[model samples]
Each structure stands twice: as C-alpha cells, then as structure tokens.
Target: GNRAEQKEDLRQLVGLTAGSDDKALLADITLRRASMYLATADYEQAVKQAQQATALVATHDNKTLEARAYRIWGRAQWQQGRANAAKPLLQRALRLATAAKDVLEQAQNYYDLGQIAFLNNQFSEAQQLLHQAIDLFKVEDDKRNMIRCLDNLGSIAILSESNFEAALTYFQDSFRMCQSIHWPYGETYVLYHLGNCYFEIGDFAQSQETLGKTLTLTRLLGDRAAEANALDTLGLAYQFDGQLEQARAKFEEALAIHDSLNDRRGKAYVQTHLGILLSNLEEIEQAGIYLYDALSARSDSGAKETTIDTEAALAWLDMARGDSDFAQERAQEIAAWLQENGTAGVELPFQVFWQCYTVLKLTGAAEEAQSLLQLAYTQLMARTQKIQDEDLRAHYLESVVYHRQIIEAFEATTR
Candidate 1:
C-alpha cells in the first residue's frame, strides 16, 4: 500500500480498538499512527496521536512505548521550530528509555539533543552528542541512525566551523552509505550539503549541479522546506557565477516558499541574499531596503552570522553611494564587533575590512587605508593557507592578487 493508505489503515486499526479493554494495544496503535503522521509532516495529527498514547500509558508499565510516544511528540514540536517546547519532552523520553534499558531509543534521544545543539550553534556539544549517538547506533547496527549522525556531523563542519574539506569527507561517506542502503532520503540530504560545500569552496558549477539534484528529490518528496533551502543555495551558486538574473529569480522563488510556510528564518536568509545580490547589481536604494528588512528579521530570529552579513552589505551600499566616511565607520564598527565576539575567522569580516579600506582610500585617509589593507591581506593569507583543496586555494590566491592590485592602485593615486 501507499504511505497515505497505510496511514489510513493504521488509523482504522486504532478506531477498531477504541472500544476494547486492551489499553496497551490501543496505545501502541496510536503511537505507530503518530509515527506515520510525523513521517508525512502531519505534525498536528502526529501530536494528537502521541498525546493520546501518552495519556493511555501514563500510569502503565510500558515504559518503552511511552518513551516512543514522547519522542515522536518531541520530534513533531522540533520540526515545527518549537525547540524549547520539545526539549523537556525529549528529556523525559530519554529518562524513560534509560529506565527501560532501550538502547535504540536512548540513541535516538541523543541524536535529537545533538540536532538541537547544532541548531543553537553549539558545535562542540553537538559533535560530542552526535558521536555518542553514532557509537550506540553502531552497537545496534542501525544504519539509518548512523547515516543521520554522519550527515549532522558534516553539517556542523560546514555551517559551524567552515571546515569544508572535512565536511566533504563526512558527506561523501554518508552518501556512499545511503546509496548502499538504497536510502534516497538520506542521499538527497547529503547532496544538499555537498552542494553547499562546493559553493563555499567556489565550485559554482558543481554546486549548481548538485543542488539541482537536491531540488528534484525534495520536490518529489513533497518537502517544501528542503526545496526552498535548495533553491536558496542554488541562488548563491548563480550569484557567485555572475548570473544575477537567475540568482534573483531563485531567491524570489525561495522567498515565496518561505512566506507560504511562514518561516521567518528562511525569509530572513533569502532577504539577506537578495539584498547582497541587489547591492552587487548597484541597485542601492532597493538593496538598502532589503538589507534593513533582513537585518531586522535576522536580529529577531537571532541569526548572528546573517545579521553581521547584512550589516556589511549595508556598509558596502553606503560606499557605493559615495558616503565614504559613514561607510568606513559602519564597516569598522562591524569589524570591531566581530573581533570582540571572537568571530574574526569568517569571510564576512574580511569582506568588511576590504570595504573599510576602500572607503578610507576614497576619503583620502591613505595611512588608515594602508593599515586596513595590510590587516585584510594577513587575514586572507591565513584563510587561504587553511584551504586544503588546490583549486579552492588558487581561488583565494586570485582574490588576494585582486585585492593587492586595488591597494597598489590606491597607493599610486595617493602618491
């Protein structure tokens, strides 16, 4: 039977047992139905079934089943972006699983907690928790959970650490395992991350190709969120490739999806990207509008990285408008904030530094411009050295040369 049919069958089974005296059987059926609902993204129905199961098993001896119900309910909440509401439910599930000596459920609980940590940008804690879950899943020979842990670890490396080389290794391993197991879901997720990694390393062609595959799979799976995410990344790939029109289209499409889903975080991210693209296209007024909106949305969502990026784009916009003094001040403020927060290793600050130098040079502050240029050069060199891939390293070197030429030209003009 198809998934919908199977879900209906489970629901019917639950209904048939509604008048029976077997509370355990009723609860078990409800839990299974809840899981089916969760898998299909029917989170409200999933929560309803899980709550019913939870009430049924509250005073019962079926700790394992109760744990399963709680876990499913927590997953539903987490999927809805209610991480705070989900955590205590997951913790309760973990306690029940531990009391019942259910290693599988315990592993699942660890994975859930690890996902929460990852979302909160607690990379080290996420790694530790995911590793523990991986060890337990290995012991149980649970290939699916193992693949999930590997995928999450790859994401942590990419998003949290910007360690693209290590992230690629993890994704490749996970992709191979998914292929071996015929798990298209996991394969699609790996492809998405692989595309993101490729984009980060300046491989626009490969990134676009991989993200295309991800888009196809997400559409086939009817996963709107994943489809939107793929579109956003594809837009980034196009933006980096200088396909501005295509990039704008993709961003608009993703924004529409995010709006339909009421996903404020997704909307903020797309807005930020669109703003950057508009800035690059010299649409200063529109760029500023988008950037300011994105800045507000990102601040509300607590997306620190994107908020910083939006600020940098706004400063760049100021520079484009010949407001060198204000641009330099804004860029320096952002640079100081990044440094004070110990977030100076990322590419955003480097970009901001370059803008600051440009502003200083334009305003005839040659000495200050030279100082900023030297600082940017040092940071770029350090970052380039950490890039293990030869092609990516060459890309960074190219950027360094371009920046050096600009500095040289500025110096000559000042002389």
Candidate 2:
C-alpha cells in the first residue's frame, strides 16, 4: 500500500488493539505505526511511537521485536536530525539482531548506520558499512534493500567531490536492478538520481528529460514529497541552463508544495536554488533575501553542511554586487570554520571552495587563495585518478567546468 494508506491502516490497527491484553501484539502494532509515521515523514510521532513500542516489549522475551523497536526508533531519530542519538540505538539493535541470528535485521542496522555515517561525513566508514549491508542483503536475496545499498553506494562515491562516473555506474546498476524487480519506488528514485547525475555531468538536455520522467513517475505514485524534490531538481537544471523564467516557475511550484507540507528543509533547498538564480540575474537585494532566508532555515534545521552551502551562495551574491570585502570575510570565516570543525575531504558541491578562492584572490588575499587553489587541484586530481577509463578521466578533467577551473587556477597561480 501507499504511504498514506499504510499510515491510516496502522492508526486503525492501534485503535483496535487499545484494550488488548496481549502486550506483544500491541507492541508490534505500535511499532508498525511508528514505521508508518516514518514513511509519512512524521519524524517526532514516529520516534514517540517507537519508544512506546520498545517500552511495551521490554517485559517480553521477544528479542527480535525489541530490536525492531529500537531500529525504528533509531531511524526516526535520524530523520529528526538527531543522528548522534540514533547511532547508539542502532548499534544496540544490531547487537540484538546478531544475538537473535536475524540476518535481515542485522543488515538493516548496518544500512542505517551507514546512512548516519554518510551524514556525518565519514565517507570511508559509510562505504565499508554499506558494503557489509549489501553482502548480507545478497545472502537473503533482498533485491529491494540491495537497490538501496547500491543507491547509497553511488552517493558515497560522488560525495567525495568528483567521481560522478563511479556514481553514475552505481545508480545505473541500481536502476537496472529496480527494473528487474519491478520496484516502482526504487525505479523512480533511481531515475531521479540518474537525472541528478546527468545534470552534474553537464548533460542538461538529458537531465531535463530524465527528471521529466521522474516527475511523471512521482506523480503516478502519488508521492507528493518526491514530486516536489523532482521539481526542485528540474528547476536547478533549468536555472543552471539559463532558462531563468522556467526555473523560477518550477522553484515557486516546489516551494508552494513544500510550504503546504511544512517541509522546511525542502523549502530551504529550493530557496537556495532560487536565490542563486536571482543572483545570476543580478537581482542583488532580493536575491540576498532569499539566500539569507535559506541560510536561516537550514541553520535552524541543524543542517550544518548544507547551511555552509547556502553561505557559499551568499558569498556568490556578495561577489556579484562587488562587495569583495564581505565575500572575502565570509569565505575566510567558513574556511576557518571547516578547519576548526575538522570537516575534511568535503568540497561542497555548491562550489564553496571555488567561491572562496575567487573572493580571496579578488580581495588581494593571494596567499590564501593560492593555498586553496593548490588544495583544490590536489583534490580534483585525486578524484580524477579514480576514473580508470582514460577517455572518461580526460573528459572529466577537460570538460567539467569546475575541474578545468581548478586546474587553470592552480597553473596560473603557481607558475
């Protein structure tokens, strides 16, 4: 059943069992309700229900059920942006699953932990954990979760900055697996990933086409959140391709949907995109409003990483307005913040590094800009080295705009 129907069914089940003496049945029903809440994006309610289920199961000897309760609770916590709290709960759940010899549950804990690791920017750890989950899922022939593993593996591959080719391979592998399993949800999501991949690889036409297909599938599945996500992404494709009006329309549409759902995070993302578009169009003051709103929204959501991304966009606007001092100050502050926080190996896809480098250079901070350029080139080459195919590697180095920019900046500055 769809997420909405599943939620309603689980709610009815809870009501039906309200006076039951069977603690186990009630606990199970409540846990299912928690899972439904999660599926419907009611993170707080999911956490509360999962906690209730855990308490109800505590007096029983059902280790598996207790583990499921913990797992659901952990997932709800992660969705609620409490990943630190989610980690230990997931670990406890994993231990229980292992003790109970429940392979699937163990695999699930690993997958969730991997996701948390990814969110925490521990890319290597995330990769290793996801690999473990994939192996266990293979043992159970769980094609559905196997697709998820592949999708996350793709994300891990690309999150290092470049390696879009590697990500593309994994996403395509997942798309094929989804097709084989007739999993519409996975298929739709993977297509959305592919559309994003195409956009990042400089295939705007293909990006638009793929995302258009994603939009159709999302609508057919009645997944409004996913539809809004697609619209935002498609809007990005248009914005980056210089179709400003179309991009604005798409962003406005996505923002309206997000507002209706009270999805602050989603709205922040679209706002950032619109702000960038507006800045590009030289709507300086109004662009600043959108960008600052996005920054505040993301910061309030505890999305530190993407908040830095919005900060970078704000720097872009500062640059556009010839406010070199302000741009330089933001760049330096953020650069220092990343260093202080020990957030390594994360070149935010928002071009934060490039933006910082440009502002520093323009503002006569040559030493700092040169240092950043050298580091960026080093990272770019590191990503380039991973592409084993000569043609693809050459294309990435030569054709990808940012890659080329870093290389040129390095050469111009150093020589």
TM-score of each: 0.82, 0.85
Instruction: Provide the global lDDT of candidate 1 against the true structure.
Output: 0.78
Cα RMSD of predicted structure 2? 3.3
Candidate 2 minimal-lDDT segment of 10 residues: 341-350
**Model 2, stretches more than 4 Å misplaced?**
1-18, 260-265, 297-306, 335-350, 388-415
- Predicted candidate 2 versus true structure: per-residue lDDT over 148-171, tens digit per residue: 999988877777545787899999
* Highest TM-score model number: 2
lDDT of 2 at 28: 88
Q: What TM-score does candidate 1 reach? A: 0.82
User: For residues 1-415, could you state the per-residue lDDT of candidate 1 as single tens digits?
Assistant: 1455666688788778878877788889888888877766567788999999999998789999999999999988777656667889999999999999999999999999887777666789889999999999998999989999998998888666557778889999999999999887778789998998787776788899999999988877667778888999999889877789999999999989887766666777788889878877888888888788877876764546547767777777888887777887777776566545644223345556665666666777777767666665655566566778887776544533344554464456557
Mark the regions of model 1 whose C-alpha exceeds 4 Å error after superposition.
1-56, 76-85, 159-161, 282-289, 301-306, 318-329, 344-376, 395-415
